[model samples]
Structures are given as structure tokens and as C-alpha cells.
Target: MTSAAGATALVLALNKPVYPLYVWFLAESAFHLSLLTALTMPLYLAVWHLSRSGKGRAARLGMVIVGIVDTLAIALILGGESETLAFLFACLMLAGLSFYRSEVWLSRGLVAAIFVLFVALEGRIGAPLMPVEEDDMRSLAFLNVTGAAALAAFIMLRFPRAERPD
Candidate 1:
């Protein structure tokens, strides 16, 4: 999660300067998004601390909840772009991976929550809080897709693999 946050912040920061060339909205939006991603790092660190303290369940829940809320907030700001929805799906994947079979209910509930929110928001939001031009939207989509894919890959790589019998 910390790596995910860092990646997102880095992408946003790197794009900040180029945003103005495309649209005024992009610059302001990138600044706010960068700030938002940066702020989440401490929360992820706290979740890490909770896990280290033997509060596995709480830490897992905290990670999912924070991830969902953060993704949802960004989605709201970005409107119903398919690119933004990628992170919500990533959150669902995280929920599934975070829980064991004994805690399937928790995983199911979180996945359902993410799904419902995605359905409720997708295409329903008329316009983004900070609207961008069509060209700018395409650029933003690229950034979003790259960031979400990176985060998803990171999460999957971190998951435990079952050992093969010798």
C-alpha cells in the first residue's frame, strides 16, 4: 500500500508540469491528486504498525477501508471515468487477497461494498468536480491506468504462494 501510494504520488507529481499544456483543469487536478496520495502514506504506515502489533484483522480491515474510501473519493473527484474505476476493482482484489478462508464473510462484504459503490457511481456522475478537456481526459486515463495496474501488480506479487509438494 505504501508503494502504491508512492507510485501514485510520483506519477501525479511527474505529470504536474505537463498538465498545464493540455488543460487548466489538469494542473489543479494533478496538484490535488498528488496531495491526496501523499497524505495516504501515513495511514498505510499506521496500518502496517497495526499488523505488526498482532492486530491482523483490524489492520486488514483498516487497509481495505482506507483504500476503498480513498479510491471512492478520487473517483468522485474524477467523475465516472473507466480509468478511475480501475482502482475500485483493485480494492476488490485487495479485499479478496487480504482475508483467509475462515474470514470469507469479511472479504465478501468488502467486495460487495466496492461493487455497489462502483455501480452506483459509474456513468451516474454527470461531470467531474474538476472537468478536463477531451484530450486531457485521454492523458489522465493513461496515467490512471498505469497507476492502477502497477498497484494491482504490487498487491498480487505480495500475496503468499502455496508451496509445491516435493
Candidate 2:
């Protein structure tokens, strides 16, 4: 849950005012990617809390739903503009699985698959799904990507250290 909160704060704080605007604008404009991404936050929080409360199976189900939505969002939003977001979503999904499921190998296998996909996609040419943005915004978006990945990694790797109810 801390990872979720930290990732949320990092995303919103770093982008400051514009991130919300971007989200709102994309939502209002009916851009599926942005809308879905924004929607995933609350669902993720729910899953996190549920897992913390020992409703692991429920949490895992919610995580799967979120992952599916994220996958659709990425496909609908395709291109370089969606790259960072795609990776972030993958990280979040894998982290959730690792944290909530007893089957660790499944999560690890998915991680390996992600790595393979990235390696396979290397050097592929692509265009932005949305219009090219100002440099500052681009850099900030990249920060969100890296920040999300870091938080997900922390959450998964430190799973054993998380507080557990007696």
C-alpha cells in the first residue's frame, strides 16, 4: 500500500497541476488510455488494502482486472507516447501478483515475458499516439515511468518486510 501511495504521490506531485489537466483533458476527449489509467488508481488502492487485510484471492482477482484494463488502454493508445505507461502498468500488475499470490513462479514468469517483449521490440520504429508534447512534459512523464517502476520493484522485493496482522 505504501508503494501505491508513493507511486500516486510521485506521479501527481512531479507533474504538478498539468498532470491532472492532462488526465482530465484526455478523459473528456474520450482518450481510452488516459481515462483507463486514471480509473485504475482507485481499483489498485482497493486491491492493495484488500491484500493487506488478507483477502489475497480477492485482491489477486482485482489485480487481474486492472491488468486487463491496462492492457486494453495500452493497445488503444499505442506508440512511443504509451511506452512508459505500458511498462508502468506491467510493473504494477506483476508487483500485485507477486505480493498477493502464493505462486511466485507465475509472477516471475510474467516478468521474464515482459523482458522478452522489450528485447524483441528494440529498434522498432513508431510514432506518437498523441500529438508531440513540450519537452518539459515529456521529461516529467518519463519520471512517472521510472518512479512507478521503482515503487513496484520496492513493493515486490520488500514483500516479506510488509506489516502482517497477527
Candidate 3:
């Protein structure tokens, strides 16, 4: 998830004809991705260990917290971007991934929506969803990066390795 976010940032940054704030964009992307991993990995590992040791309650609690954080972050970022369809897709996907035993359906739905959105946006199927503001672009980038980090943390915490007794 962090990789996806960073890649998206990088792609957006490079899509511009002129390279302004190129270095900042790349640096922030990397920093956010790494920060996300750093914050989430240990908790995921700990949850896995706890579950393997038969501490299901604590693991579940941790997962709930993860879910809350992920939902909030994604909501903030997508809302900030004014990507309503994407936000809906993200919310559904996150909910399914967090709560459902089978997440394949949710994944498929999100993928399809994302593909359609990408194509539509590229082809200008409708008016721009959000106004493009040059000054706000940098701030938007920062919000997205932070939101992506939060999302990555949630994903890692929610879908940890299955616990198996040795």
C-alpha cells in the first residue's frame, strides 16, 4: 500500500511537463513510505506473535484500532482530493479487507473502479473533479503522503501473517 501510494505520487509528479519541486516530491514520497512501514511493521509482528501464543483478544483489539486509523486517513486524503468515487471504492475495499474473511471480491471491485477512474480522468469523461491549484499542489501532496502512510499502517496491521504454532 505504501509502495502504491509512493508510486502514485511519483507518477503524478513526473506527469507534469515542467519539473518543479521534483526533488521534494520524491523525497517526501520516500519519507512517508518508510515512516508508514516503520510505524506498522512492529505492531503487525507483535500481533502475529500474540495470536500465535493464543492471545486472540489483544490481537483483535489491535486490528480494530488499525481499521479505525486506516478509514480515517483514507477518508481525509480522498476527501481532500475531492475524489468521491475513489473514496467510496476505498472505503468499501478497506471495510471488506478488514472485516470479511474473503477479500478477493473487494479487491476486484476496487481494481475495476480504479481502472475506470483512471481511464475516465485521462479521457476527460467529465469536468475535473477538483480544481487544479498550483499553490495548493504541494500541500495536497503532503496530505496525500501522510494519508498514504496512515493507510499503509492500517493495511499492515489488518492483514498480518497467519499465526501458526511451531
List lDDT for all candidates, in order. Answer: 0.64, 0.48, 0.39
Indicate which candidate wins on lDDT.
1
Worst-scoring 10-residue span by lDDT in model 1 = 1-10
Best by TM-score: 1
TM agreement with the true structure for every prediction:
0.73, 0.50, 0.32
lDDT of 1 by residue, 1-166 (tens): 3333333334333443543343334534444443444445556566666666677777777777767766766666666652677788778877887777889998999999889988887777555675566666676777677767877887777666557899
**Candidate 2 on 49-106: residue-level lDDT in tens?**
6666776555654554455454445434534444444444555455444443466665
State in Å the error of residue 103, model 1. Answer: 0.7
Q: Give the residue spans of candidate 1 off by over 4 A.
A: 1-34, 163-166
Question: Which RMSD values do the candidates have, in order?
Answer: 5.1, 6.8, 11.9
lDDT, model 3, position 40: 35
**In terms of lDDT, which candidate is stronger, 2 or 3?**
2
Model 3 clash count equals 0
Candidate 3 lDDT tens digits, 47-111 = 44554556544544444344334333323332333222332333334434433345456555554
